[model samples]
Target: MKSPQALGLALIAALALSACQDKAAAPEDIRPVRYIVAGGQAEIGGDSYAGEIRARNETQLAFRVAGKVAAKLVNNGERVKKGQPLARLDPSDYQLDLAAKQAQLAAAESDLAQQQLNLKRYRELLAKQFISQAQVDAQQNGVNAAQAKLKQARAALDASRNQTGYATLAADADGVVSQVQAEPGLVVAAGQPVAKLSQDGPREVAIQVPENALDAVRRAGGFRVTLWKGGAPLEGKLRELSADADPATRTYPARIALSGDSRSLQLGMTAAVALPARASGELKLPLTAILDLQGKHYVWTVDDKTLRVSRKPVEVASIDSDGASIASGARAGDKIVTAGVHLLREGQRVKLLGQ
Candidate 1:
């Protein structure tokens, strides 16, 4: 019903409107990610490690002689002194036996005197040829037997005294009573833990490390300690490293002695042991550089003048307050993605954030 020119114009307008609607209907595309490139010149400080306080000398105090635990003078945590009587044993029997031994010793002494007098008489009689030589020899034998008996009695008395003395628990050194296993009237076996004496001294922080880290620790040179009580971070050295690995965990125990005893340092206080890692040679990137893809560790880096992320196998050397210290799998001048890496994949295009 319209003219040819009008129809042509309407057709062109409808085509243009259709093109506009098509463009509007299209979904919005995601924007490229931007990342910051950082240099690896920083010192990869020590990473945090869980640690505990331990006593270098934890002694288990025990009784030498087996007896009924008669008196418990001090309970756990009770202060004791050297040669201080912690408990007493039932000494009535030992005392009686000791007295009997003394009596026996006295009898032996009397018999020895009599034998000596008899020997003297025999010798004088033999000299005058009034008695046989065999008689004098018999008197001499009696004197020797009496002397042996006296020795035996003395030994028995000494043993009784030792057994009686062992009943009391004495402090070997000045320490706080950590534990008390024996109670009053409780029969305890010999050499059993009657008490635990915790020696007094400045406390230290201890930590357990994996065997793989032994070499890393040595190369790292020194370590730093950050007390969990929020005290000032202190520098310390690696005091010890167990040569043998723990069978249960296959980890080695590393003890770090704090430089100075801080007031907040308490026995059994938890701490974090961080070692300076960046100073030691390693690929150190920002914290955001680490990326995990399907159970594998990697980082996004620039390559070929394009932001292309690739799988980089990195051995975590240490974790510091600044960033992580990578043992390997990266080198200097590698541009690592600092943000938006979670949604990234191998060979994915990336634009530096805030660039």
Candidate 2:
């Protein structure tokens, strides 16, 4: 028979051993994580910019002469041909000025004819010895002065005629009137925009690019434009890029010319331009996936078979609003943990959120 003190000691040892076994058999903590598949069908490191479909050539139409607008001949979105009347100014003042010039020209012609007759008479008198050579010379000088005055008057008359014709504003090319800025009663200065015209021709996509992406945009091979209303992506070539940033938006305005069959594109249609990635064949991951320890960068990659998370050292080429571009360490079709990266450890068992 065992002693009471020995029985107590045995009981205590058994309880301790049971506790140890329970702890050893317990399951490990499995962290649930969100992950992304790298290098899928979507191109990594590329960018998309919202833009608008616009005519390759848009012009602000204005009158050559300042006057009170008498009539606006074209409405918004109206198509006009070259030399077609677009708007008209009040012709009352111009007509009166033309009449005055015409009257002055008539007076000058009458004076010139009278002076020529006098010169002829003076020469005849000199030939007959009735008048001195000095008198004939004076009459000839008067005729020459009259002729010069007549030419001046005629030139003034021609200018007046042109001014009268200018009272009616005409379209310089075939286009659609996108906007009208003047009313019939408004008095506008010469060269002040009265309407906006979109010339008929090839179309372009107008996009605003940030300063940081200017180099990428310049180096891109080409662009693909997709309309907001849905259509096949159209190929585009960079046509114009503003050297100076826009004061209001602080973005560089860029125009991408569309190639092949842009006739269906209308002005002001919203679109998006896809800019190619700066570097090709590189994996891209979310910024959250990047784990920064000290000065080095790392990502949490998942094992396909074991579903274990491992810390991966990666080389980041660049980081932007889109995400981070992985230059090395990660490749296409690799699964990466995008969330809860800071709490994860190497070889930690993980449960994919959607799996």
Reference-based lDDT, residue 309, model 1: 66
Clashing pairs in 2: none
- The 10 consecutive residues of candidate 1 with the worst lDDT sum are 36-45
**After superposition, which runs of candidate 1 have C-alpha atoms over 4 Å from their true positions?**
1-43, 211-221, 240-254, 261-265, 278-280, 284-298, 302-335, 338-342, 345-355
What would the per-residue lDDT of candidate 1 be over residues 178-240, giving only the tens digit for each residue?
788778788888888888876665556678887656776766666677767776778767878
Task: Please give the lDDT score at residue 25 for candidate 2.
Answer: 100
Name the TM-score of candidate 2.
0.93
Predicted candidate 1, C-alpha RMSD: 5.5
Give candidate 2's error at residue 146 in angstroms.
1.5
